[model samples]
Target: MPALRLLWLGCLGSLCRAYFDGPLQPEMSNGSLHHYFVPDGDYEENDDPERCQLLFRVSEPRRCGAAPGGLSLRQELTVLGRQVEDAGRVLESIGRSSSYDLDGEESYSQYLRREAAQIGDAYASSERALSELESKFRQGREPEPRDGARPGDACLGLLLRARALLR
Candidate 1:
């Protein structure tokens, strides 16, 4: 189970890198993109309230741009998709682990079921968000860059720490 989980995580990591780190397409270039970043009070200046809401929901309401991490909408969606995939793996691991039990406690099994359901809900939410963001990107809307670390920076650190611990 552990081996399978590790393999799944490795595949997911590679997929994320491939999807987000690919060469920038012509439509993704600076001039062709629409900026998500706006100075404070500048959101109101824009005519597209829906776009503002979609791009800025991941950010603090008061702030107009990406979080301190410079996470554009596309990158944020990718991170969210990665997180969903990870969570699905976790749920699958739990299910697989539970299946090995010859005489599992009913309460424990019930708990696992509930947890799996919750994870499913979360995964669905992440998928929906990713879909929405991708739709926006397909429409030529791009998240503006802001000052800070890149998206998934903390996740990378955590993954590295986990690898070290596993070793």
Candidate 2:
């Protein structure tokens, strides 16, 4: 009975690998990367997104427009099976790496609880988003531009930055 329960928990945890935060917007433009040091809305005039330009900072390493880090969707789904085999191995490591989990015994416990709650919330949201995306993919629908330009073409130059973030 205990083993069966463990297996159930493992299966549930495996489902979570499909839920992940989407990728950050890839940097665009060539030449130096520009950014206004000021926070958004700090200056009314500087509020223009165009104001920001990539600056060549000697200390900060510039990232090339390469693929995103982490597993791709298929890869992640594949790993999900391994994780289901032993949720402890994956979940325990993730919990330990979190800062919340490192704040001493009491804090660690609190952190674990808090992080678990956060993960649950995030998982729900990701599931919903993924479902919508999957439907769109299956329908073979192209994103119509809200503006004149096509959807992601104007934004990230990729149809799905969210999908790219998976890799």
Candidate 3:
């Protein structure tokens, strides 16, 4: 029928095709797509292992850091929990002597105790995950100095000085 012929002609007329004299992938060379990023050596730098390969659209193993971080907030909460426990322990210990001396001292004590309890609960909930991260972190942790002083000891010494300052 003329209607069917017209429809086919119209469809063919509306359709379009693109063509280029050069190759499909201009940047491609040596039959590898690496040409795209190879020009910018910054992205393909093999020396910096810390650089996230994901940014370069490259599939390579990367150290996400001391904590395995991908949508997991446990590591963040753990750090917060440690800070909370330390400060709360110091505050609660200091306030124990005269918890009733201040007007809101009772409420303060209750609040700190409740907060510490909550932190404990959080840790208990993520104990398994936290333990797994702990092992991985210990393995990835930087080697201690060959000298007599260890990095952890040095950090602890600094923390002790900071506590002394707080007192």
Tell me how far candidate 3 lies from the true structure as C-alpha RMSD in angstroms: 33.9
lDDT of 1 at 100: 61
Candidate 1 to truth, TM: 0.25
Model 3: per-residue Cα lDDT over 50-166, one tens digit each: 443222233224346444444346766888799999999999988775565443545767767877888999989799788999999998896756768765897899999999999
- For model 2, how does the per-residue alpha-carbon lDDT over 25-82 read when each residue is reduced to its tens digit? 3354343435556556456567555565445533323354435784666786788887
Could you arrange the candidates by TM-score from highest to lowest?
1, 2, 3
Superposition TM-score, candidate 2 onto the true structure: 0.22
Flag clash pairs in model 3: none
Candidate 3, residue 12: Cα displacement in angstroms equals 66
The whole-model C-alpha lDDT of candidate 3 against the native structure comes to: 0.65
lDDT of each: 0.72, 0.67, 0.65
Highest-lDDT candidate: 1
Per-residue lDDT of 111-153 in model 1, one digit per residue for the tens? 6787788899999999999999999888776666567878888
For each candidate, how many residue pairs have backbone atoms clashing (under 3 Å)?
0, 7, 0
